[model samples]
Target: MTGPLAGIRIVELAGIGPAPFACMMLADHGAEVIRIERPGAKKGGPGGDPTKDILQRSRKTIAVDLKSAAGIGVVHNLVASADGFVEGFRPGVTERLGLGPETLLKVTPRLVYGRMTGWGQEGPYAQAAGHDINYIALAGALHAFGRAGDKPTPPINMVGDFGGGAMMLAFGMVSALLHARTTGQGQVIDCAMTDGTALLMSMIWSFQGQGLWRDERGVNLLDSGAHFYDTYVCADGTYVSIGAIEPQFYAVLREKSGLSAEPAFDRQMDPRGWPELKEKLSAVFATRTRDEWCAILEHTDACFAPVLSMAEAPAHPHNVARGTFVELGGVVQPMPAPRYSVTPTVAPRMANEQSDTEALLDGLGYAPDEIAALKAAGAVA
Candidate 1:
């Protein structure tokens, strides 16, 4: 608890994907997060190792069965002292459970209630079950991925889930918390993945509106349309990415890759010649290993780097020097980001090593006997 958000407290209704990731970011930056899990919920990381689940780190966990009135009462007690709350259930689910914004805001008037979903709170697809791909597809982002002749490639879950949903929710919660501290008011944040994904494409949309971009997938400059801004396979079957967009950087690319003497490469901005230039560049790149190309163009203004896999990324010299990744509980994972000069963030630890039900109930003003009775009644675990 050393970062800028050290004094803040958040209550997270335990969920998968975006909501958990948002809670993790808040907890990482020193917000004290209490994760409320259901009784008998699975307790392990993605690989069945509890410590390896990076999304669940840096939080205290308590099990409360929301079906019981006593369980709902426990949440209300926690909300009375919490600055914010988060949940990712479908629309109206929390309302049915008596844990909606209207119910919780009555307990703490300044609470920031964050809701995460795919299609959002109100829409034709709001109640339908969907995932990251479906949301980004509707946002016009999925159609912009992949090569010209190839089908749309799902960029895993990064674009919609972590990037759009979790990151946006975290930003909204912090913003709403700031406003609450100033005016003593609370509000709901309807953080839909579809809305967030669309917001993330603002720059691309601008390009299209200005007639600088085409609607096709791989024909845009930032996409894989430009020969100088794509990945290439080398002699060793390893890959390297090039992003020599500026004239100066592209000149360095042409020089270092021995393409300066070729007149065909001079037409860098000609879209009609991109296909031919890309073929020639691919052949040139295949003549050398990825490491060889890195040695030639990596340090130059060519904007080049080897396309390291997850296994190689942590071991890269630049990443190691910056402490970008850390090993905790025998698991290698990324560290909390966006450093603060004054209030440096503390290192994160494994979550839910043991239950905190008794301690939490005690702090909530519940007597030991009452806690025992609630547990006996199958209300808490």
Candidate 2:
């Protein structure tokens, strides 16, 4: 944990969904994130293996049964020593758990409290149970995907879960942390996945208002509307993506593919002619294997690329050159993102599960007898 946020300490109340995802991002960026997991919590939730969870990488874990007053006291103690805290419970759940903002903020006056939810802290659906698809469905993101004539396609929870959910929580927490540092004040960040997803759809909303986009799915400029801006299946059953948006880039694509003599694409921006041009381009692209098209246009600014699978992305030249992925604990996964120039980050140490529990408690100023009692009661794992 040695990056731009080298010294920031975060206390995370472990739960599911966006909470762990948010804390993971924080831990990745060099924050000292200490996760408080449930006593009997299991591994392999949404993110990954609890032991090998890349998202939970680089964080210290303390298991506590919140049903006990001592467990809640442990969280407050951690908060007193931390700069911030993040939780993903429903609106009143934290208050019921005796760790609400009002109580914790009194203990750690300068703490930034980040709260993540699907419907938000107070709303009609605030207490309802829903997943990423349900949240983004109301936000118009899901409605904008899929083929033109087909129903909307769910993008596998990435938009709402990771983008709107985890990413938004991270952004809000950082903002609150900055404010806390400067104003000597702490505030609660109410990060709602629904709101975040809706915010992400603003650009498409603008395009729709201007008549540049259609309400129908997959017919907008970036949503497979234009032939050059969509994925095309190659002769080898694999697919490649193209994005020759600008006229110059489109010209490069034509010249490289030996289609400059074709008149179908003479007028690029005419919506009336887009259908015919797309048909012609599709035909031309489908003739070659994905690799052949990559050889012709991948390196150029024709804005073309092969639609690499999950396994292929880490091996590509660009990803390899950028060191975009790292292998740890016999697993190859994406590296922590948003690299810093001055403070470099590293992968977390994988000691035995909860191996440092007693030592960590000892270091945190907990008395030896109290720690032994916690273990004796099976409240701490």
Candidate 3:
């Protein structure tokens, strides 16, 4: 509770993926986030401990039967004291439960209501079921992946789920919160993964608009098309990434990898020769082990580094030096980023299973008898 968002309070309807991720980010930065789970809902995480679920960490949790009127009342009471709220259900789901934006805004006029979805609140495909892959595919981002001749590859769920969906919702929540604090007028943020994915490709879209980029996969400069801007397998069968996009950086790459005398590399920007140049560069890179090449090219103008895996990334010297990852609740997860200068963030804690239900209700002005009655009636757990 010692970060920039120390005084902020958020109420999150329990969900998977992006919604929980957004709440985790807010909680990591010191927002007091209360997660409401459905009674008897299956616990999620590694094994059965929801606390170990990295995305669910750093928040207090309560279990309530949303079907019960008392449960909706509980949420309304929580909303009255919250600065923001998060939900990831399909459009109209919350409305059916009497917890929609219109209802909550009436309870707290200064609340920022954040809605996360793949399609959005209203659209032709809004009601259709989809995940990260489908959303990014529709956004034109999935079409930009993979090799020149290979079919478009999905870059896991990072692009749509976390990058476009969760992060955008978190930013919207913060921005709307700021606006509310100033103008006393709250707003609803319809954070669509498809829209966010397209926004993420603004640079590439600009390139295409200006006729500087082709509308094909892996044929662009930033894609795997360029010999110097891609990952290469080494003699040891491991990989290293090269990003010598600029002339100076490419010169360093050529010098370090002993390709400086090759005349073919001079046509660096020529797309027609990229395949042949890439083959030649691949052969050169295959001559050395990944670590050997790292020694020659890492920390240089060559813009090179070994392509470390999930198990290897945390141990890398650069990541270790920067504390890019941390161990919490015996779990290794990424640290909260974009370091703050003045109001620094605190270490995150594990998610508890309704450990603070009674306390939260009491704080919300529920008397002891009323809280006991609600529990006895199976409304809150």
Candidate 4:
């Protein structure tokens, strides 16, 4: 339990996607994360099966019926002993559940309250229900991510849910946590997916301002507008992504891929040459299977790599060398990210949910008989 965040305690309200992932990442890096689950809701149940939801990877899961006064009180008790709390829900739901910041912060004045929502707590659409796609669409992220002539393809919710939602919420919470530790004052983090996604587009907006990019999708330098920056389907129908933006890297890509020392490729940044250069690169790349290309160009200055699937990515040579993935509960899952050399990360043991309701209560200064009474009342599960 003693690593980078040895004394930090975070209580997460049971939810989906980014909330759990942020907690898992936090737990992986040595935060004491206690996930508050609804009573009888099976742990790790999101992967359509309780055992397969690997993202629900860490933390002590305690099912509490928030509708019960005892259960609501339990959260307040936990908050009092916690440095932060993370919850992902539509705006107004937590306040309606009586666990709102206004109420809980009164109990724990120095607790950092982290709220994750698609539209944030005060926006007009804050109360509306939405998923990753809806949030991305509102952020102009969906519009900026497609082929010139093709409909925008969703990027597997990485842009919205995990990147914008969970990660941003975690960041805000941690920032507030650091602040509270120094000043003994708590704050609320209002993390919105729309806001986070827009933040992700800052560089893209810069390109647009210089007229270097089109408002339309896939016509920008990094948005597959240039042939040198796109994926090429090889002979075996697998893809090799090439992103040699610099002239030095592009030169390496051209020479190794056997592209002639042609005028078009030589002029690496010419917008008029993108289509033709892309076509030429496509033809050449098609001559080799992905494997063949990797053998030739991977790890070189070409900035090329075989676009491996999730199953294939774990077993990749470089990734395996780095121990980027680990097998857990009979599933191959990604290892805890952002490593620490001195204070190492540890995998959560057993996928087990262990919270001595009495012990947890005792940590919050509750007596044995008080915890027993709450359990007898069917409040804590």
Q: Give candidate 2's whole-model lDDT.
A: 0.83
Clashes of 3: 0
Candidate 4 lDDT for residue 353: 51
Quote model 3's TM-score: 0.98
Please provide TM-scores, in order, for all candidate models, with all chains considered together: 0.98, 0.96, 0.98, 0.95
Better of 2 and 4 by TM-score: 2
* Candidate 3 wrongly placed segments (more than 4 Å): 45-48
- lDDT tens digits, residue span 278-315, model 1: 99999999999988888888778999999999999999
Candidate 3 lDDT, tens digit per residue, 198-228?
9999999999999889988888899898888
**By lDDT, is 3 or 4 better?**
3
* Tens digit of per-residue lDDT, candidate 2, span 263-304: 877877776777777788878888999888888887897888
lDDT of each: 0.93, 0.83, 0.91, 0.83
Cα error, candidate 2, residue 163 (Å):
0.8
Which candidate should be chosen as best, given lDDT against the real structure?
A: 1
